[model samples]
Target: MAALGMADRPITVGAVCVYHEMVSTAVEALKGSHIPVAAVSTGFPAGLSPFHLRLAEIHESVAAGASEIDIVISRRHVLTSNWQALYEEVKAFREACGDAHLKAILATGELGSATKIAKASMVAMMAGADFIKTSTGMEKINATQPTSLIMMRAIRDYYERTGYKIGYKPAGGISTAKDAVQYLVLVKEELGRDWLEPTLFRFGASRLLTDIERQLEHFVTGRYSAAHRHPMG
Candidate 1:
């Protein structure tokens, strides 16, 4: 809701991700509005829950009009080298989303290795993730360039193998316009401009809108605007 009105009053937000219960309210509030509802499902930050519950959460979020579903992969399974089981879990979640876009979250901070990151990226994409995302915003280290490079390379490889162009989303701790631009540059340089649109590129930030507004204000008036609140749409 805040994201919606912010977009109206000079702040442009492509999407707002919320928990499963909040999906319906967000959809209703932002209906006919431009902001897309991206729901965080699949046991989110902890990534420790029963598989059936996670899948049900995905189903409910999609049924509630979520256009995109951000789900965390079971970090435990991935870390244990259970590649086949991990792949099938993601595939099932992808199917559960129905028409909603599926973003498989790697939670890279916990994975702890570039090799693991690369393999996880490949597994998620191959399991039908529309986008392979970085983190859940509940950790200290979320998205880093090296980690992003690994995933981007994995996506490139996947595209080469299957003719599918997967998207990338870097969530958590990306709070500055400079950082956003850097990530954008990374995407453009690594994945090409074809993936620069909101569909393929998104900054999962809680504070990004304000920074963008400040940037836009500078672009228009040559000065920073005072802090303000945008109402729910």
Candidate 2:
């Protein structure tokens, strides 16, 4: 927080994401900074908790002041080709958000195939996910180029069919500035400039920020600093 506050130029992340228990603490720390506090709810990376418990978790997180909620979807719904069940589940999660932007984490790495990933992305948007995220950063594969491409195409197709712009987030494994730029380029080529804004696009790579700071420092000083020089906290 101090590092963010002391940056030479204006630089703020899309939001500070934390587990539900830390929502209030993040909210308190980011007070007056205009950065929304985002919480990972609905059993997070697993999403295997009881259905009612998942919905209740979302409600609790929002009530605790999380303006954004990242909820994981049940991979079983996709694996079993139960699109209706997946849609209904995401819809319930969205409703529970109560005006908080809902980011649906597909956990693409676990979905088994490109076809399933595409189908899951479409279902998530259809159910009112403000964004369709690529991974939970805990999956075995995390975010890969092919998975991201599939999700982006799904986003493009959904936008064409419904005329509603849904955001995209490629989380996990994107830790370098080069990798970050590659995703940015992919989004621009696949989704166009409109999705480039922070409101419509975000990288779930916290370590990317550190590398960015390092690059910026090198650009300004003609010397590359150690990674420890830039701390996320």
Candidate 3:
């Protein structure tokens, strides 16, 4: 994984997303590299655990030195149109995260429609999430351009209303240089130049970095490398 971080430029990933139990290991391995260990919490992928336990998980992850926490919102809240409840729920998670940045996962693929995805994104931002993510990568569907587009629009609207800048991360199914380039283009076109940076945008993908590195190597040396040569986190 550290080998993957050796790559240069826009192709180099911003953070390595991991599960809670791996947070300490990731933090130790990534030391002095400036790469953040983003751990999934709040009963991630399903988020159906007891509320207290979820909040405790967030604290444990932070205590273990996870720089960011990607928490999943209760899907029932969004499906039932309980906006205030969802806002409060996310806000509690944000508080539990303490100094660690919070990225609320909407699992857009399971939310049923673009409207729900947009609304959930807005509610997460309103609740003080530092970033809004597309999915947990465990959904039947994860991170589509259409859903991502809706989420990005919601982020834009939030920025316009509050004058606060929230980050965007499109996790799952984003592989290859073309897909990354497309996402970059979307951010550049929708949110402008500032959002192009890692502080604003990220890919919560495991294999995406290898592909991006391969493309970079091909561009520079005019040759492609084996997948094993680019060990990702």
Candidate with best lDDT: 2
Please, what are the lDDT tens digits per residue for candidate 1 over residues 1-233?
25334545544576878998899999999987778899999888786788899998888898899999998988877788889988999999999998999999999999868888999999999899999989987888998888888999898899889999999989888877899999999899998998898778877877776777677667767878765742220
- Model 3 residue 117 CA deviation (Å) reads 1.0
Tell me the tens digit of each residue's lDDT in model 3 across 30-90. Answer: 8988888999998888999999999999999999999899999999999999999999999
Off by over 4 Å in 3: 1-12
TM-score of each: 0.90, 0.95, 0.92
Candidate order by lDDT, highest to lowest? Answer: 2, 3, 1
Steric overlap count per candidate: 0, 0, 0
Stretches > 4 Å off in candidate 2: 1-9
